[model samples]
Target: MRWISKPLPNNDVVNSLSKSLGIDRVLAQLLALRGINTFDEAKSFFRPNLAELHNPFLMKGMEQAVQRIFTAIENNENIMVYGDYDVDGTTAVALMSTYLLTLYPNVVTYIPDRYAEGYGISYQGIDFADDNEITLIIALDCGIKAIDKVAYAKEKNIDFIICDHHRPGDTVPDAVAVLDPKQVDCHYPYDELSGCGVGFKLIQAIAETLEHPFETLIPYLDLLAVSIAADIVPMDGENRILAYHGLKLINSNPRPGIKAILEQVQKTELTITDVVFIIAPRINAAGRMKQGIHAVELLTEQNISLAKKFASEIDQYNADRKELDKKITDEALQQIRENNEEQNSTSVVFCETWHKGVIGIVASRLIENYYRPTLVFTKSGDKLAASARSVKGFDVYNALEACAEHIEQFGGHKYAAGLTLLPENYHAFKNAFEKVVKETLTEEQKTPEISIDAEVDLSYLTPKFYRILSQFAPFGPANMKPVFKATALRDNGYGKRIGKVEHEDDLPEHLRLNIIYGADDKTYNAIGFGMGHQLDEIQQAETFEAAFTLEENNWNGFTSLQLMLKDVKC
Candidate 1:
């Protein structure tokens, strides 16, 4: 792992901000490095306000999209809300469909099956809309690259309003309006909205047209928060504001579906990370294990009993998904090993019978071991569909675009993408993709990076400092939790492994230790998960250092701060 230190800001500016904000010089320096300079910016960073959100109308094509939707509602035309099968896609479907149902009765929702119809706007979905006499389709989380599908829908007298955040193709789809900030002509101030964020903006515009207050839409933010966390979008600017309030709703009074899922989890309070790990997976499992409609049903279900049943079903789906994912991941790893391709320029593994629902996740898992551009493929009907994930700084979508000749269709962001090609073209595409990565990528781009936010002494670690850091809540892709580096230390003798008095065959030993490290030599205790193997190493060492985050852990009616170690070096 590579520890890359970002270039720091000038000392004079850091000192001034530190003095003005009444924060430590190191904290101020880190803030400045992240482009937070003025007190107003600092205040906004600390307290994300709903008032800070940009006007929904300011987004390019938002006005046209809003007018088209209002026209459909006024004419009482049958409308279908179409989305992908992932958490973002399902959440967008739930949010838009539920909001529309509250105001109109003609709205319906549809999510394509990941296994059968694959991703994005499907022709089968279009046929269902046509057969039902649906005149309007609001495509969310997808449809940015559905130019042909949009044209096909147009032939059936159906109009489309695409609310997507994926990177756009050369020509925008022939739709009523395309609301993707990644479009070159789009001028939305923030370009990192999750799929559901775009859906929320669409609903916000509709609410504005109906003369309803924006507060009427606050309840839907929980869906957006889940999508934002799942899609790994940046949590800054308006996105942060959405997540901040959305988390409050989750903690205080979540909707029936969310509450049902949270009841089974062990955590007392959930951060954005917790939502990503716990809630997003269950929601995504609906899509991955079955159709994404189960997810929408779970999110929109009003009855507690029905919601609990849906949650329980989703939990099972998630468990099944884990098993299938593990099997496919292990097989892919074995394939790479047998082919002696672990040291290849890129990692491309294809299994004709692999479960189509979980290839994207398998692709992501492959990156952890290979640390290179990866593509996982499965048979989808006569063609082969694949999901691509890339190392940092290398744009997988662009590389896929470079090999467009072999691809039947493709669309996604810089880091992640999805594509389909003829089964016969898989080997050729794989070779071309590896060549592209080998030629274009630098060696440094392949190594994983651990970014240290700042360096601090143990003495600077305090409850007050932790509280200040907590103000930067709802951390995600762009706004990450602060990681500090502390070095040079001797144990203060407070270190000891705390566990049960006896050993049982089923129960493994757990490590809980207190140790002091730094120039000041202040005392602190640390908890390491799955680190019992390190007990012997730590016991034999006289000095050690670690990169960690200070967090408050509460157990058995007592709350105290502890160090959550990321990496330990002795």
Candidate 2:
């Protein structure tokens, strides 16, 4: 792992921000480095107001979508809310379908099955709408790339309104409204909204048309926040405001479904990270391990008792998913070794028996060991389906496009993608993908690198400083928890590996540290997870550099500031 320090802001500007904001110089410098140089910018960054959100009508297709929905309501025609199967899709489906039902009772919800029906706007889903006499489909988080499927729905006299955030192909679907901001001509204020965010914007526009105030939609943001966190969209611009308010709702007055999901868990307040770990996975489990209908059922259920029942089922699904994921991941790792492919620039492993739902996750796990682009494949029906994941600064989507000749179907963003192909094409596609990434990927891109925000002394790790830093809540892309570097750190000679202590050998898998550095007499304790390989080097060195984030560790009911090591250089 490489530690890369970002360029620091100029001293004069940092000092100016420090004086104006009445904050510590280091805090001001951090803000300046993140482009919050002005006091007003800082104010907006800290206090994200709903009033600052972009007008829903400003999106290119929002007006058309609202008009179509109003027409459907006026005609009393059935409207089906369609979405993908994952968290963003399920949550967006719940948000849009439930919100529509409040104004009109003819609305229904549809989710394409991950197994029976692959992804996006499925023909089976359209057939369901036609059988039910549904005239319009409001497709969320998908349909941007379903040009042919949209045409098929059009032939059935069903109009489509696509609310998606994926990158558009050369031609978009023939829908009444395409709300993807990634479209070349469409200009929404922020292009980085999650699918749920786009769905919220559609409802916000509908609310305006119905003469309802904006605050009427506040209850829906919890879904939006969970989608934003799980989908891993950039948390800046309008997204920040939505997540900020959504978190407030989650903590204070979450809906019965959300409240029921959290009934067994104990947490005073939940952050975005917590939502990703605790909430998103369970909601996603419904689709991954079973049919996605359970997820929409859970999110849309109104009664607490019924919601708890749905949550219980979803929880069990998550447990099943975890087990399947672990089993598949271990098998994939073993496959890499059996094939003698560990030295390759990419990890391409396949097993006919591996579960399709967990292949995406296994791809991510492979990156931890191989530290490069990875693809995990499994048998899907008669063909082969694979999930592709990339290291930082690499575009797996582009690489897939380069190997398009052997691909049956592929769609996704820069870092992650999904594709399928014939069993015969698997080896050729794998070779092509590896060749493309190897020739195009930079040396630094292949190596895992941590971006360090600043270099500070151990003395600066004070309660007051940490208090200010903690205000950097709800961290995500563009705004992340700051990491600082401290040089010339000599161990107090009592550091030892901690985890799996029963081994009692050189490789204990974790290390506990006691260090004093920079003329500071205070010895701070640090834990380096998975850093047991560096124990011999650290023991030989008199002084070394440690890159870390400041975290408060609670041990035996006592809380103390500790160094969360990112990396160490001797």
Candidate 3:
């Protein structure tokens, strides 16, 4: 792993901030590196305020969307809340549909099938709306690229209000409103909201128009928090505020569906990472293994009993997903070896019978082996569908755009995307993609780089410092858990490989170490997951540098500080 330490702020600024905030110089330097230099900036970073949120009307098309919803409610017209099949989409659908149902009786929700209708606003979904006499459709997490589908809906007298955050094409869908901050024309203060965040803004606008306080919508932020974290959007700006409050709700007064999912977990407080692993997969499993409507049902269900039943079914789906995800990932790796494509700049593999829902995850797993742009293709009807994932400093969406001539359709962000192509064009597209990336990718881009925020001796660590770091809640992209580099680490003779899962075949997949820094008498416990391979190298050196993040571990009813090592080097 390439350890890249971020340049620290100058001593003058760090000293000033430390004096102003009455914090350790190290803590103040961390804030300064994130651009929180002034007293108010630090204050806002620690205590996010809803009033700091951008005005809902500041978005280009938000007013139009609000007016359209008002018209639907006034005339008692049928309104269908449509969303994609992923967690971001389903959560938006749940949030919007539930809020609408509270105000009007003609509201319903819809989630397209990944196998049948594929991604985005599907013609089948529009047909269902037409057959049911629904004249208004609010599409969440999709429809920005549905120019054709939106036009088809328009011919049938169904208007569309799109709440999306994806990059727009040359021309956007001719909807009544397109609330995507990524659009070149949009001037919303922060343009990095998730699909669910956009959906929340629409509801916020509606509430304001109805003379309701902003607190009226606070209950829905738990859904917003999960969507933001799972979708991997930035945690800076308004997103941080939403996540901050949403986490509070998650720990204090979560919805029935969320509470049902948390019933068996024993964590006193769950972080954003916990939500991504424990909650998101279960919600996403409903859409991946079956239909996302089940997710919406779980989130919107009023009765605790019914919510638990839905949660139980979704849990089974997650179990099934994990099995398929693992099996398919192994198969994709084997395909790469058989084809002898290990040295290629891209990893493109396919299977005719692979489960379509797990292709995206398989693409991610492939990257651990290849460390480059990857695409995992699976048969979708007559055509082949693929999920694209890219490394940092690489734009997979732009790379896909370069090969768009061979693609039937594609849409997503810079890091991840989805696409489909003809079966005959598979080999050609794969070759073309590899060529494009080989000519364009820089040498430094291929190696996995671990960015370190600061280099500090272990002696500087204190319980007081950890307490201040814990306030950096709701960490995600742009604002992440600060990574530190510690050198001169010597094991306290208890360091060894450990395994707790049977699937690991009793072979250690993790390293548990009790180590002292330099001549310090204190020792710290550290665990490095998937880093058992480093034991041989570490034993040779016996003293090396480690890049890690500070964490609190609770075991056997006792809590203590632990370093979550990201990488170790000799």
- Which candidate leads the pack in lDDT? 3
**All models, RMSD in angstroms:** 3.1, 2.0, 1.7
Q: lDDT (CA) for every model shown?
A: 0.87, 0.90, 0.92
In candidate 2, list every pair of residues with a backbone clash. none
lDDT (Cα, 0-100) at 319 in candidate 3: 95
- Backbone clashes for every candidate come to 0, 0, 0
Residues 516-547 of candidate 2 have per-residue lDDT tens digits of 77664689989889887788789899899998
| lDDT per residue as tens, model 1, 39-125 | 889989888889888888888899999889879978989999999999999999999999999988999999998766777999999
Candidate 2 lDDT score at position 36: 85
lDDT of candidate 1 at residue 431, scale 0 to 100: 90
Instruction: Kindly provide the TM-score of model 3 when superposed on the true structure, using C-alpha atoms.
Output: 0.97
Q: Assess candidate 2 and give its lDDT.
A: 0.90
Q: What is the TM-score of each candidate against the true structure?
A: 0.92, 0.95, 0.97
Off by over 4 Å in 3: 266-268, 501-506
- Of models 1 and 3, which has the larger lDDT? 3
lDDT (C-alpha) at residue 569 in model 1: 67
